[model samples]
Target: MNSQTELAALLCSRLCHDMLSPVGALSNGLELLADEDDPEMRKRCIELLEQSAAISTNKLKFFRLAFGAAGGFGDNVPVEEAQEVINALAAGNSRIELNWAVEEQSLPKPAVKVLLNLAQIGIDALVRGGTLDIGAEKRDGNVEIVTRARGGKIAFDETIGKALQGEIAPVEITSRTAAAHMIALLADEMGGGLQYALSDDALVLGAVLPQPEGMIG
Candidate 1:
């Protein structure tokens, strides 16, 4: 198989892994509700159902914009909408706090996708729960995306770093590195570059994409 074919397969695996948790919980909650008899237990089951549903929905929304075809060509997507999806993804983990600093009301869909993917990686690096601060802006006629994950016990995957830096060979990529790989691929296609700094307590990811006219201000 070709390199792109392998990347697509690995990405599918990652999306399936990510979706399985909440979706499976939702299914289990529904099953439990059906078999539940006592009123109190039934109420508890309902609450679980609600929580699972919210999680599934949030993941769906995030994935739709981040991976699927939310809107590839047209008016730029509102930054608020992009931020909301990132917030939703972060909300799943109470340990990670979100600080959004993008001032633009909207950004090109490609830029937004890159932002979302970077945010996802940062959020995942907070192994012990930490601050995930994200910021984006127009600079030197390019969209500069920045994300920082700082915590007590942060863990940065080496493969992810290599993937984002365009150092990983596609054939060696796995489900875990798919998101980073995709971000690197997109940035390259846009005549941009990706960089990162990882340490014991902090992990930072940045990307610079050639900005379209009037897209960022």
Candidate 2:
């Protein structure tokens, strides 16, 4: 397949994989609600359904901004909108804490995309739940992005690391590394680069994108 087609397919697979559990929970909750007439059980089922629905919504919103076409035709997107989706995504896992500090009121579309994707990766790395620190700022005509995950355990995939470094070939990209590859491509396009660090309990991903002269101010 061509590069665009291949990337799209892998991304779709990733989205489906991430969404399955919550969507399945919603279906299961509905089924349980229909089969039982007990008051307390019914209440429990409703609560579960509500939780699943919120998770699904959060994932959809995050995907829309991170991977899909958001911000309309504008050159920049509001920082608040990006924060809302990332916050929602982190909220789904009570065990995970999020710290956001993006100083810019708005960021270029490419910068926002990289920021969201890196944050997503950081959150995913904390399999056993931990803290995700995300910060971005405009410095020296560049947008500096950083996302760090700290937890008891970190699940940093080698393939994702390779993808982020532009070491993975287009034909080799998979659902798991599609976002990483996209980040690398975006960084390259913006005359920037990607870097990362991984240890036993932490993973840090970063990108430096050169902002157009008037984009950040």
TM-score for all predictions?
0.93, 0.94
Cα distance off (Å), candidate 1, residue 1 = 7.4
lDDT for position 86 in model 1 = 87
Candidate 2 lDDT by residue in tens digits, 1-217: 2568878888899999999999999999999999989999999999999999999999998889899888645788999999998999888689999998787788888899999999988988999999999999999899999999999999988889989989987667888899899889889988899999999989999999999767756
Please name the candidate that would achieve the greatest lDDT relative to the true structure.
2
Clashes of each: 0, 0
At residue 189, give the lDDT of candidate 2: 83
Q: Per-residue lDDT of 126-213 in model 1, one digit per residue for the tens?
A: 9889999999987778988999999998777788899889999756688888878888888898899899998889999999999776
Predicted candidate 2, C-alpha RMSD: 1.6
Candidates' lDDT values, in order? 0.85, 0.90
Alpha carbon lDDT of residue 201, candidate 1?
91
Stretches > 4 Å off in candidate 1: 1-3, 72-75, 213-217
